[model samples]
Target: MAGTTGIIGGGIVGIALARALSARGEHVTVLEKEARLAQHQTGHNSGVVHAGLYYKPGSLKATLCAAGRVSIREFCEEKGLPYREVGKLVVAVDESELGALAEIERRSAENGVPDLARIDDPSRLREIEPHVAGVAAVHSPRTAVVDYASITEAMAQDVRMAGGSVRLGHEVTGIRSKNGRVHVTTPGSESVFDRLVVCAGLQSDVVARFVGVDASPKILPFRGEYWELAPERTDLVQGMIYPVPDPRFPFLGVHFTRGVYDNVHVGPNAVPALAREGYRWLSISPKDTWESLRWPGAWPLAKQHWRMGVDEISGSLFKPLYFQKARRFIPELKSSDLARKSGAGVRAQAWGRAGELLDDFAVDQVGPVTLLRNAPSPAATSSIAIAEYIIEHYLVKAAA
Candidate 1:
């Protein structure tokens, strides 16, 4: 609390944390490997500001997302950024999904999702999403979308104004703790800090090892690919249409989202990536692939989810198969409506050596170094609140 603070990773979460710490008069410096911030998961996402519909009640995700969305709205207003409440509809296409949909409704209610409504009548569902096909659905009118990259840029500006340095292209290479000081090394640079917070999204686990932490929670890069709706087809989705997700899988299945810019896009089918930064199928890293395969958790995780793995991989490879998944929500959808592959993001999904997904936000500390072990999806939504939580529990209170 008394010396310079180093926050690794230049994504929204890291920048948000930097903004907070700098405002508190902590000398903060952000180290990002990319030439600019928001180049990874922060920039390449569905851009939906989640409404806490899927997270477990009383969980960190639920608590932070509830607070973070409000904070994000306020921040957008203050910064004159685009914040559109396009709403979200989670549909149960058939009776088989009704029970899962009901559980989501229960969770949403307990999580206090604003203006959440359960619709059993097909007509009511049509009123919200005219083209959506579903036996039942839940509507969240307050669910919104924003330009996260823009938001992150604004936060970075605030950090600079508050006297913190946002250093782009400064990838962290090594870290050493000695005599209560953290020594961080980058190519052609070395810096010492009183406290270090690692928010390295994709390389978080790798960096944690640099701090000499356990390697149990390994980062498994899961790539989510999306497709753009044809210009004429964008109107088919009024806001966002989603499926009642499979509880066993950590993904939300392929869905339609109307971005803050008013462009509708489909997908983000989850698939394993060949590299930690793998976005496209051709962007392969033999080393990253080998490491993931060699990890103790990899085989068990695959063994448990081989069926889902096969399904997702098939969808990733075949447009027709992917179209079938999306057409479940919108029966009128044509295969051609999926104009082209728009973009993709690699998620740094963490799993235990025992083959279980690390669901909640996890934080670990090693002396003066604090590591954000697992923070995916809703992490951008919960960034500011997460920073506050870390400050209170890890930094400020720890100092006291």
Candidate 2:
């Protein structure tokens, strides 16, 4: 624990781990590919701090998110950053979705989601969201919002204050274990460390392969597109408004969200990205596309979800179709009410050679190199807890 530790990827999880390791008196250095931190998912997300509503009980997401929700609030308060408990309502627009809504309520209860309640009364649902229409809903009063990029930067500040180093523009080109140490090669320099932790979000699979890890469970990018609400119409959504998620998939359906600054936006229809970092339809990388196409899992995975994929792509292309889906929840939403398309985020979803999507957080140590293979949605919310977990479970044992 007293030796030099190197972490790849400057996203929230990596920075949080660097801070935690530095706090424990280890010499820590963080390497970021871009010139800044949180350049990817951390910066582009809806900024909603999940309240452990959907994850299965006893899963890494459930345990970490439950603890993370409290820790993030405390950390934000201590740092004087903006954190708001604006609440969220997962509404079922019709009787068909009522079953999914009830299951979500059950999962929330199992996960010990704070102040979670089933609102079956139409009048009460109206009280919570006047313009929203739903036969039933599960309300989480503690579901909050925060700027994740700000939190990542603050964590970097904490690392620097603790005498740790943050090296920007240090794109990790290679990773190898020599003797008992790990060597991380950047563009023009190489650094040797007692241990290495890879938190590469979008490039996780490639980074893992650099350390001689398997190629299955490859990283697949799913772009989530959003639309901001008109300034005057922002008043329509008081907090977060969501639809009951499909149990077959990990993505939560398109919904409305109120940011920490009180700006409301809707969307995030999921469509496959041409590149790992592709945030738009036109952003394409031939190398990345070839890699995905050649991967064994891509074809079967596409076959299984082809219909949903087509529907999502159609929704992404046509604004009227997109608005139609959202109108199920907010009946009054009009095409004129939606402003220009705003920010977008690509999820680093992991798909196995078996053609299955990984549901939980995946991390495994190959000697001195630790790879964060799959970390999606609740990752930002659970970053602090995940940092503690890595240090206590992996790094501690490695040092010992």
Judging by lDDT against the true structure, name the best candidate.
Answer: 1
State the lDDT of candidate 2 residue by residue for 183-229, as single tens digits.
98998999999899999999999998998879867988999999999
Worst 10 residues of 2 by lDDT: 246-255
Which pairs, if any, clash in model 2? none
lDDT for model 2, please.
0.90
Least accurate 10 contiguous residues by lDDT in model 1: 245-254
Predicted structure 1: clash tally = 0
Query: On a 0 to 100 scale, what is the lDDT of residue 110 in model 2?
Result: 94
Candidate 1 lDDT (Cα, whole model)?
0.92
Q: For candidate 1, lDDT tens digit of each residue in 20-110?
A: 9998999999999999999999999889899999898898999999999999999999999999999999988889988999999999999
